[model samples]
Target: MNKIETVKIPRHVAIIMDGNGRWAQSRGLPRAMGHRKGVEAVREAVRVAGDTGVGFLTLFAFSSENWTRPETEVNDLMGLLKAFIRRDLAELHGENVRIRIIGARDNLRGDILPLLIEAEETTKANTGLTLVIAFNYGARDEIARAARKLAEQVAAGVLRPDQIDAVALDAQLDTQGIPDPDLVIRTSGEERLSNFLLWQAAYAELLFVPEYWPDFTRDVFYRALAVYAGRERRYGGIAAAAVTG
Candidate 1:
């Protein structure tokens, strides 16, 4: 398919990379192997998003809840993350892909902290596709953090409770300046949000595909965009042409 010519791609796309363990189990392999394979899919995803003219691609790399998994698996995931950054950082920077990481970083382990920082600092000046890696993130945690900031402002007597509107709260969010995702996708046929982008996805379209995360190919990304192109986003209003004409 001529994706750029035929599909109306969304400006920001977020993906929940699910089914790694399941995919490995299905293939009679260790879960760590599945996570390794998922990394390859991530590379293809970034490439596809850039080629398709997507301005922002936010990947749900590791959620806050992911910390509850087995220690070995969690360590494996972290290792993979570090490996990906070490291996792909220079290339991504050279290609002008800026990296933005959103999550609570105060609790990050000593060794992992520097790597994440390096990725962000190295690509902060690049102006191409903004690759947002949502590591150790949860929508509830993000919202709670935003709420705390607003509460602090009110307690300082600089802001009134009544003045705290959606815009005020949005400014305190981890995604303060980032555009809300236009499309959210979950592979492995999952139909739930799984605690991802609960606030930012207020009006985003969701597309669930049956393929596992490891099998999510560039073709699948194009297919998702094609699906999004056919949607009629009323955004709680009547047809624009009818109202304006």
Candidate 2:
């Protein structure tokens, strides 16, 4: 696959990493194996995004609904998340990758908080790519939280109801500093967003692939960009016709 140059690349790309369990089952291995392998895909995505000079890459690492999984799997996932943080923080910092974790940090383990703090702090000064890890995120939950905040402020007489708009609400969302996703790619042939980034991906170009997260590669990324390039993004606006020669 031909790689798209930076000039044509989307500014922000989000991904729904799916099919880990099915991938593991197909290989006669524990489901954790799929999750483990998926981490490599993440590494590749990060490196490629950095190389391509993409502004933002948000990976749906975990969602609020993922807690319904078996307790053992959940624990394993948590452990793997921690291990990834421990193993990758220094490298991310050195590579100028600013790692910012979104979603509910309250659910994260006590031990993990310090590592999260260190990771964000260490990479805070870096300027390459803003890699967002949606750990315990749900788009609905994010919007609800923002709404509640707006209501509280209104009740306190600090703001008026009409003052609320997209920019105002965006400030309250977890992805305050980051741009809304321009493209969202889901692996494992999943056609749904599964509540990944409901509010942020309002108009994002979505691409679904049959390949599972464990097997998603830079080539797949290239293919996705190619598809995106062929798309006509009207964004609810009418386009002007080209002048005849």
Candidate 3:
């Protein structure tokens, strides 16, 4: 395998931590057990990213469509999220990791909203890698929400319809200030984005690994970064090497 180029590290990396339930079911264990184990993977990913010099790491923790799952399972997932924040917040702050949540919070449950707010507020001053948790996030929903905000601005005569270009709309996104992901990875061999970071991943290098989220390790993360380093990001233009060749 090729070595990871330290200088080529992505500024932001986003991951769709998939196949937690499947990982448990395949082992004849409860799906909740898989999610619990996946939490450990999340911890390792953060540490690895920080150590690898990744400035930002976005995790697709939960999607808006997740609400369609079984109520008991949903509740269990929520409990795990609460537990993770309560258990890891102080440690992350001490490590200089900034916590950022990018998702619609308009109607989040009372219990969940406060915890999310607390996590972000507690780590807002950190200077290290920013850990972005996309809880209840769906890229399409996020785009629509941003569009609605633009519409409202137009209605109030604060902006004109002709001025609602990509930049204008981008400013209204939940990830407004954050840079777009440089690489997007999905575990469990999932090749599709599944409504994760559609807008922000327009130019990201996408990688799909067969391991489930629970099986993700620092080694696997490092391997993915190596793959990313080898790719030539053309961004719709010919690579400089190609042009020179």
Top TM-score model:
3
Displacement of the residue 33 alpha carbon in candidate 3, Å: 0.4
Runs in model 2 deviating more than 4 A are 1-6, 240-245
lDDT by candidate, in order shown: 0.93, 0.87, 0.95
Clashes of each: 0, 0, 0
User: Which residue pairs clash in candidate 1?
Assistant: none
What TM value does model 3 have?
0.97
Lowest summed lDDT window (length 10), candidate 3:
1-10
For each candidate, give its TM-score against the true structure: 0.96, 0.94, 0.97
Clashes of 2: 0
Stretches off by above 4 angstroms in model 3 are: 1-5
For model 2, residues 1-245, the per-residue Cα lDDT tens digits are: 44565367889999999998999999999999999998889999998788776799999998989899899999888888899998987888888899898887776766877877788888988988999999889989988999999999999999999999998999999999889898999999979998888988888898999999988889888788778877767676665443232
* lDDT comparing candidate 2 with the true structure: 0.87
